[model samples]
Target chain A: MALFTEAFLTALLAGAISAGIPLLLVGLGEQMSEKSGVLNIGIEGMMLAGAYTGFLIAWKTESMGLGFLAGAGGGMFVALFMAVLCVRLGLNQIVIGISLTLGAEGATAILHYFQFSRTYPRLPATLKWDIPFLHDIPVVGPALFGREPIVYFALFLVSVFAYLYRRTHFGLALQAAGDKPAALDSSGVDVLKVRAVAVLTTGALAGLGGAFMAIVGAGIFVPFMTHGNGFIGIVLAMLARGRPLWVLGGATLFGACLSLTTALQVAGIDIPTDVIQMLPFAAVMVVLIVLGSKANLPVSLGTAYARGER
Target chain B: MTSEMAIAPDSGENERKSRLNMRDDRLHFLIITIGPVLATLVIASFILMAMGVSPLDYYGYIFQRGMLSPSGVQATLTRMGPLLLIAASLIVCFRAGIWNLGGDAQFILGAVFVAAAGPELVAILPVWLMLLLCLSIGAAAGAVWSLVPAFLRAYQGINEIITTMMMTFLGGSLANVLVKLVFLDPETTVPQTRTLAVSDRLPRLFDTTVSSGVLLGLAAVLIVHFTMNRTAFGLRLRIVGANAKAAVHAGLPVATLTVIVFSLSAGLAGLAGAVAVLGQTGNVRADWNPAYTLTIVPLVFLARFNGFATIAFVFLFSVLSIGSESAARRLGVPNYFTLVTMATLLILMAVAEMIDQRRRKRKEV
Candidate 1:
């Protein structure tokens, strides 16, 4: 009956990974959007779209791989709206984003009510690939090394993004798209196209992250299952100061805090569970307050881009 | 007229131009406002047809039940009591160019505080005094909840969006905690605040089922519209919202105005919470969050932040919401479909707004 056993600790660490992966994927996608100055407030809606489509397809097809793909596709479909309205039409990013999220929420809820609300089909546990020596080392080993193959891909994306931001010409265009669209345009580049691509990429990434939540994390889809993970992704991206690894770190820390909350409640702490549940959100706020000032954000983050207008 | 023109050479021209502009604005407002609504209906009808539900039946049901029937009209008006207050709060903030997304959280906290305090106060105090105290508590709780995010935004240059949303999550959890732990009514097995008797709650208007909260909502929106349009303080806030840098250059208290906007909007939201509880539910339960904020965001936007237009929109929204529920029951369509309808309307509204903006820009050019 004692707490903090090897099994207990392992489960806790595993829970952290399960919770953190969606944030990682979402944060990385939001990073891409922010980098191109789109803000992409529809991250939550995109995630919901991904989750719904990902779960529906996976359940019907009985393939987690296909589910993740559908999730990405679903996210991109919603993101296309962002690309069209906010990027192409020069609409208010924040307004469209909130509306998109609400739309997605409503759309997904109705879909669920029709298809899954009555039936409530759940997928089997997600298959994980165990790394030979590393996965056997202990709690950290099993938690980190024995994750689904996508976890490794998600972790590796940080490095890839870092290199992309630092090395590529496209990266410069993306940066310029966000920071100085007029200058980027002057250089004979299509700023809108770059932004659209960035937003689409963001949608795909967010969708995939959402699919991971349903397929790997919960093995089921429910309305509002993303549960503000998309917003946290935005926060992580913002607080990371345009650094990919920092998003990983922030997501991890938030995940760790979430796990601690779960662990405390499970341990029968002599306190209200709701108070414990508030920790992660409160922690994020504290982090944002302390570091938000120092986080150098995009210059044209929320503003719509246009020709010959300030 | 000649003397007036002689005194100020362009006065006649300016007056004529303004009169013409006012007419143009009215036309533009009608096109912009009603255009998206019709578009949403058309688009949603196609989706409904695809889903095997009769679009005619759906719209017919909404029209008959929500608009035509007296009881349905009462329910819609009852629903509007809180909705209008929230809309007022949103219009205020959006006008000041701030997003007050934390309305749901502020609302819940306010309602919870009032629900906890209302029953206790009614025992000792007169009905009028108790109701007044409860309303004040609700407003105070909501304002207090927003203070932190407002300070963060005004002082530290933090985005109120993140801070306010974060506060919402925390506030929701805190509300549940307060209900379950502190205010648990011992008389009932359910975890809820002690409910006041219906007689002790907000008085019924004209001996009808509708609560007096509707009057409060109407008053609030009108007061806000007048204050924001016809007053210097509102103009200052609008200036700060329009361009903070310009306001600062002009020696306006931009930071303080920002804080005021947050509080005023949040206070209205809290007042909404109080109205809903006092006028209808009479108490809060654990995990009781209606999340009217996000839904109302589109409604306020559809109204173009104009109070009069928002009143009409809120009424339409309540009708849509109330009618959709019964229609869903009759047609076997999920109730969530109304949200789909709303989302479509919101998008179309954005498109219309975009087009309108383009037309304005071209006109300016």
Candidate 2:
């Protein structure tokens, strides 16, 4: 009985770590973007685009690290396009973001089709980190220490981001840009540059999240496989209320919810599987409801700043 | 004073002559009617030519193979039916300046609800009555589904775009659940709802393949267009949409209008679902790919807010979709190239608008 219980706990922990990494990366990345007053709702599409690009690059070059960089670069491309629309053109941010999501989705699918036109190539498999001596441990090693280095990197990023946002000059400028771009502008910070860099970096990190899943988790690129994780990141960002530290908590909670849903299905509970699958979304809804009740968006969030206007 | 009055009358005469001259400009009127079609043709031809095919032949083949043939027209009309209905619904909300990105979710919920409700209602009522009940049920479900984001936007001030979009994805999952758990068809190879009863289906329009659903969609469009363009409520919505603060200053009920417009838009989207189940698919199936909600947005926007233009755009898109599939099979081209083409066209259109706005600014300067 103890053996079975330990095995179950090990699987649950493994699932949480695996699932949480992507959310953590995406949420933290999006938090940085939003903190600079740009909402990249296209993150999901960008993730999918990155997944394909990473998979294709890895498939061709047979290099895992190159694939990861390609993924981040692919995401950056889309983010730069969004910056052009939102910052340069002064389009409605939400519409432009959504439109770019649609555009990216269509473009990514086309890219996938063209890449696999001559031959079917599988995603580059992720390498597991076999920690010295830790690999000898029974369940804990496999559950915690056996993940790819990328997973550790993602978790570390969460804390690093939390620290940066909490205590850094650049982070302060980003926050100032989001809440009061005018103040930042007056302070001689190029608000547009700050916002642009923030959005671009968000894309790169989100792309990394996609590469983690496509290369490591599933080892294949599937259409719409990010499966609303990008939106979930948005919800996470909202729940965090732009606090990087809170984002860690929010992402872990979401990841736990996702892991629980999977575990429940495996446990063969009497509850409907769809109802369980819906838990993450339900959690997000609850967060949004609370966030909405609290009215917590930065006062100037989701708006493009026009210079010399009032 | 008498000489100045004489000159004023002459000036008025010149103004009237200029107005009459504008009406006489037939060439300008022709451009307005023929410009979009020409643009579409030119783009389509250029694309076909670039692919090393004769554009004229391809156009002819499409017309002869799809539209001129009975099945072609029937298919076109069949596709047109739901599209027109959905586009009209989209138009209503857009006109009110509310972006309901939740159309897809509303659509899926409507399908799920009708799928669940159709068979039971058929046993209780006659065929036509059952269809009506299913549609009403579907519309109600959509409205209920849409209320979440709409209410959030109105009361809590959440951004409707994300909330609506999130709801759409959730609704899709809910549809999957319905198919997998509630109405899982045991006989099908894939997860899908049970086939609805034949009696519950919409009547065929002709002895041909076309269904009465096409007429119904057209009727809905006409009714909605009238409601939007010719009604006081619609005018109030337009005012509210254009400037909410100004609308309030003008004593228009902006809040009430928002709720009404969103509900109506969602209800219309639900009707689209009902039509799909009753007229086209004859059952709710999870096998349906692509998010219909996202699909409808481009269709509506690409219409540039004209109801008449929406009808044409839907027809054009349906043809492109079917034609692209045929091209994939016959020409060995990637079928999704159609979506790529459509996306490119959309981005181009937006760019064109941006350029136009800039030119206007330059002229003003």
Candidate 3:
């Protein structure tokens, strides 16, 4: 009858990891785009599209791999419009981003209604790989070291992104594209091309994250199931301010907060469910405000680049 | 003497070419305005086909039910009340180059406040006075909700888009909490605020089913349009929006204007919430959001800040929304198809605008 049992605590830790992986993937993707000076507000749409497509593919083929690939493809499909309208055509980024999200939501919802409304199929349990020595440890070992392959891949991406941002010419070009596109252009780099690649890569990563949410986290996809994870990812990326490690930390913190809320509700805490739910959102915002107050964004973050129109 | 003769003939030819370009420009303007709408419809038709529904049948139902039928026309007109008001709110903020994506939050807060306070106030005051107070309270709450992002953008240089959206999420959660926990009508099994009686509600317009809120929305639009176009205060706000540095050099109070613009824009959204409750919904319920804010964004954009054009676009949207509900049921498609169409329209409009800009630049060259 004890509320703070070891089992309960272990479950909470596992839940946090489950919840955090999507945010981490989305944050990393968003960071890449922001680094190239594109604020992709349409990521929510991409995530939703990815979720539906990923879920559909996984359900149809019983292959998680193909599902994830389709999810990324779906996300990239929406991102293509973002690239064309906002990046190539020199339109308003925010407006186009919003339109894409709305469009994606509608498209995915309609697709779900037609294909799966009558019978909402849930996926089988996901396949997880256990690390040799780490899995033998106590509660911490199982919760951290034993996860689906995507979770490990998502975590590994932090280091990969860190390396890309720190020690490469492509990384330098991305930095210059965000900070001073004209200078980058004059230096013989194609600013638009760099931004296009970053935005597309962001779509693929975000789509994968959404697929993870549907295929592994929830084991089922529902309309608007990505919820506000995409927006939360934007916040994480913005607060992290070019630091992939910071994104990892923020995502973990946010995920932990989400678990805490669920734990509170399950324990029959004498508080309104709505207020309890608000905890994660409020906690993330407060932490970001305090820690990221000094974080500086790219100089020309949301502006469209024009070659000679200074 | 030979150079002068050559120049005179060339000048005559250039004049004819310039006149031809002028005529082409007018035709281009017409195409640019209508092209996006047509593109959106065509794209939406493909989506319909994929769903195994005939696009013609769906469009027919929407037009017939939304505009042609008497009852459908009434419903569409009634629906326009909130849509028009929210469009007005968006116009105000977008004109000032501020993106108040928190309109949804402000709107929900306004509705919550009005629903919580209206029933009690009716006991102590006359009906008209009580309604007025409820609206003012709603507007005040919405304005206060927006102040956080406005203050942050004005002083701390934080991006309003992210902050406002976060606030919207917070607002939605808070509204549900208020309904389910704080203001729950004890007699009802459902989680909702105390509903006002019919007598306490806003009277129907001209003995018709349409709410008088539509009239209020129209009045707000006209006043806002005139203020934005005719007044010096409006000019100052526009200058601040057009170029903040130039406004600063002109000695304008940029920060103060930012605050005021946010307040007025949020106040309009708040009023929309109040009107929706008093005129139609009657109370606030848990987990309810009409999502009027985002739906109206594209319409306001297409209208290009013209009040009359906004009214026209709002009418078009209302017809689609009201008409599509039955069509969705009949065609076995989700009602969300309208959102897809609106989003497509917005994207196409942006593309069209870009093309127009390119053409203008070429002409300048």
Candidate 4:
């Protein structure tokens, strides 16, 4: 009711960003993958893998940084496996992606069962960073300035990706490969090599996002911890029309919806919690419906490459 | 001087000659039957070993407990009720080249509808009539839930895989909240529905835990198999699945077929849920995490979308599940070991297919 209360709005925005960070990382990664012509539907599985690996490593080693790296590494390895199937084996990409997602989920569950017997301790790993100058700049600054390191990392990556995608040759080539692989091939670039790297990079970022969820957000590894974060990322990437910078906007909106639902529940809304929980997914569905109608994606985004076509 | 140019046998001639005799008996067996049975055994063994139990002892114990004893047989049948039905439901869609991963949700919706309707219907109707209503409502609920992804794919072009999966999540959470808030039995320590009257429950077969659902599931399998192989609609479904563009060119209503097949598949899942409620659980509960929905993928994969293969795969998975529990109790191993085996076998099956594809490529070259 108190819209003018700077403190109340600040706290709300802060919490929204906290929730948004995971989606932001995932969205950025998926954007890169989609831009390069691979729809990494296995993003959720990769996130789950990251969550398990991050939790297991952090709990065992008591090193947050190492756990994060382990998560990224785990995601990269799985993404590379997917790359092998899609890029080298020429299986149906959609089926391969779905299979990879299932595989990651199955593998994570199995490995975690064997490694820790699903009994690892929850270790608090995320560090809260407070900027000296920014923290002193009144209500807004204090609210946003003091948060987890991941928030900053997510924001930084958004800027980096926006630049790389719009201004760099590598970005142009990657985008071109998605829209017209033949052109990229004719230009003497190895499309497979570029796409493989793009897919791996996407996995690493998604893994990092998932690691942030486990090590920072939850402080423990619960089963299915990723909880469709990767899918939300896909929705965000799609909603953004595969534009890297726009992914941040999409992630923020989705994140806000999630945070608002949770907040509304806490605020004792009369609606069922199930209804509230469906808001993010509903939002994504709506966004996809709108964006899919308007946006024209790359023609060859989901198609397989023929040998030496150029 | 040493020899004239030697004439080589024409490969094209060999191809033409082999065309009529193109039956690869071994490959056919691998595809149709052996693959599923082998995958099941491999997964079952992994699960047993991981539980620190010897597979031999576990299998022996399962056979003794689950197959030999009357009570054990009832237990196995009870477990098979939902799984068989779910697998059968999957067969209908998968054979038509559509994958329905929302079975978990559909199943829960059926349960929810049964819980919501059972008491009200009991006041006005006979037990059999009430049961029929519950089953039909359940199927309707499932069909409604399925319409989202079906419509999206049919018209808007959203990926059904993700959409269907998202619905599963939504359905699960919705079921949980309903169980917690609406149908909860206040006296019970955990959230669940009030137990229904015995007359309203599914009829037990010869005073055992096994209900009539097993027969119903088998009937479903037969019906679905016949529909796919013998019917005009089934033919269109197969063509559309194989190539939508070609099917459209051939004057088939691809969109209508897509929606109908999806609805049929989801309705089957819903029926599975009703069976679980009336026949197995005898009441609804929040423990709606039916792992079979996800596990069904591997089962269907092993079966290659064949109805009989689906039954065989389900039976195989059931044995493994039951055997794993026996191993855990006897050998002090964890039950999740079974899942590990199932996953490993699934990956292996995919890899095997990939290898087969490569072999074909080499043969062509």
For each candidate in the order shown, give its overall lDDT on alpha carbons.
Answer: 0.86, 0.73, 0.84, 0.74
Candidate 4 Cα deviation (angstroms), residue A192: 3.9
Query: Any residue pairs clashing in model 3, and if so which?
Result: none
Binned by DockQ into CAPRI classes (incorrect, acceptable, medium, high), candidate 1 is acceptable
Give the alpha carbon lDDT tens digit for every residue of A265-285 in model 2: 555545665665677666666
Tell me the lDDT of candidate 3.
Answer: 0.84
Best by DockQ: 1
The sequence of per-residue lDDT tens digits that candidate 1 reaches over residues A78-123 is 9999999999998767668888898898899888886666667889
In Å, residue B135's CA in model 1 sits off its true spot by 1.2
Once model 2 is optimally superposed onto the true structure by TM-score, how far is the C-alpha of residue A264 displaced, in angstroms? 4.3
Which candidate achieves the best TM-score against the true structure? Answer: 1
Off by over 4 Å in 3: A1-3, A265-270, A288-295, B1-30
Q: Candidate 3's residue-wise lDDT over A133-176, tens digit each?
A: 99988878888888888888899999999999999999999999
Task: Give the alpha carbon lDDT tens digit for every residue of B283-351 in model 4.
Answer: 787755664676776566555566776776677667667766776677655565565555555555666
Worst 10 residues of 4 chain A by lDDT: A2-11
Greater DockQ among 1 and 3 belongs to 1
- Higher-scoring candidate on TM-score, 1 or 3: 1
Runs with alpha carbons beyond 4 Å of true place in candidate 4: A2-11, A34-41, A91-120, A137-140, A167-169, A172-191, A261-272, A286-310, B1-28, B31-74, B94-100, B185-189, B206-208, B360-365
Which whole-number lDDT from 0 to 100 does residue A210 have in model 4? 87
Q: What is the TM-score of each candidate against the true structure?
A: 0.94, 0.84, 0.92, 0.84
Candidate 1's displacement at residue A241, Å, is: 2.4
lDDT of 1: 0.86
Candidate 4 deviation (Cα RMSD): 7.1
- Candidate 1: residue B310 Cα off by (Å): 1.4
Give candidate 3's TM-score: 0.92
Q: Per-prediction TM-score of chain B?
A: 0.92, 0.84, 0.88, 0.83
